[model samples]
Target: MPVDRKSLFKRVPSGIPGFDDLIEGGFPENTTVLVAGGTGTGKTTFAAQFIYRGAELYDDPGVFVTLEERAKDIRREVKSFGWDFKKYEDEGKIVIIDGVSSSVGLPSEEKFALEDKFNVDNFLRYVYRVVKSINAKRLVIDSIPSLAFRLAEERQIREVLLKLNTILLEMGVTTVLTTEAPAPQEGRISRYGIEEYIARGVVLLDLQERNIELKRYLLIRKMRETKHSMRKYPFEITSDGIVVYPSGEIY
Candidate 1:
């Protein structure tokens, strides 16, 4: 008898509307995915939605490690989308890990705060401890470029992320690691140009001049182990959150 490899993995439903169908119902379990985009491309919203929807709808706990914005600011920002991150955090369904306060030498009001932002090992251990505490099933590390600021060399950055990937896999969680991508480039996908290779999947969100307007689009540049859409699909940021039109195409 032949073996079905994909059947060995379970799908981790992405919370974004119309998004999961494109990726075969969701991201693969126990894999780290990279969400890369330029400014105003809704990278944060997509990643946040993954954490928020996982906790609220699926009964899956999540950990959102904000690297760019403070935890309170993120909570407040996502409130407009009707996704109450703080509410879930309060209920122990999710954790908003404050990576910002430690970077700027400030005290975070959030329950979880990284004590040392400069040491990659310390940051990874802190995340490990918090994720285990909640038994979280989904994880998001917003904007890896901010994390790059903590390290002095690209080698160290890659090594740290590889370690982080291993940590996420060991915990059996589907993770979304966000990073900033430069504007409409030919080949450059991420700010540091090294993040795409570190994760098992890479999703790109971009804005393009289409149909006489600047339309937002999303593409799965690469997703290892599972068949996924290769076309640039249209998406929007609504009051509810991001919604991907899997059937719609751009260009």
Candidate 2:
């Protein structure tokens, strides 16, 4: 069997509003994008909305690999936005892998083994099979930091991520990875060094409390082969989902 590397490069339509407009036209044909942010910064909402938009608007089935939450809980939480996860699941459009189960279900006797505990290789293989089966073009890993922490060494983590990104990109699926910032400080967002460099694009989400106003901003730090808006654009998490304002104001 041979992999047609060229077959994986096809334009993917992003369902998010202002976010896509900032980066020319969504992500590249086949690229891995990192969306790193802290808690309460709307990372899951953004990723969910993106995948929902893909299924409902673009007719592309997407896979969401969540490492922290349950699939049912995620559906319930996002229901206020009118994203019917059950409907999508029934229609065979959206699929969620319960990484929480993998992470927590380590042996009672054995403390931990990165692979024994959270085998991302199995996860990737499953995603690859599903993508090929359904011809899926969009994929997301809710958070990669969890996987990184489980790995004992930095080199091993980087090696695994590098290989995963290469294979996923080679498969021609436009992917997004969600990562939590270590702390609310400069250069504290992404710890794994090669994430930003290796990934085709990077989007940073920041939320800060100033006096009494809680402001949220989205910055397109890097996007290889594309001209992107470099401003820290204001955004909000609404009942309808994430909305990035035209001007730097919370609308």
True-vs-predicted CA distance for residue 110, candidate 2, Å: 25
What tens-digit string does per-residue lDDT give for candidate 2 at 58-107?
Answer: 88888887766766678789899999977976787877655565567643
- Per-residue accuracy of model 1 over 1-251 as CA lDDT, tens digit each: 88765576788889888988887778888888999988889999999999989988899999999989999899999999998777887899999888888788887776788875468888888889889999999999987888888787756777777788778889888889999888654678887677887788999998988768999999999988788868899999999999988887565
lDDT accuracy of residue 75 in candidate 1? 90
Best by lDDT: 1
- RMSD of each candidate relative to the true structure: 2.1, 6.4
Which residue pairs come into collision in candidate 1?
A: none
Best by TM-score: 1
Full-model lDDT for every candidate: 0.86, 0.74
Query: Model 1 TM-score?
Result: 0.93
In angstroms, the error of model 2 at 116 is 7.1
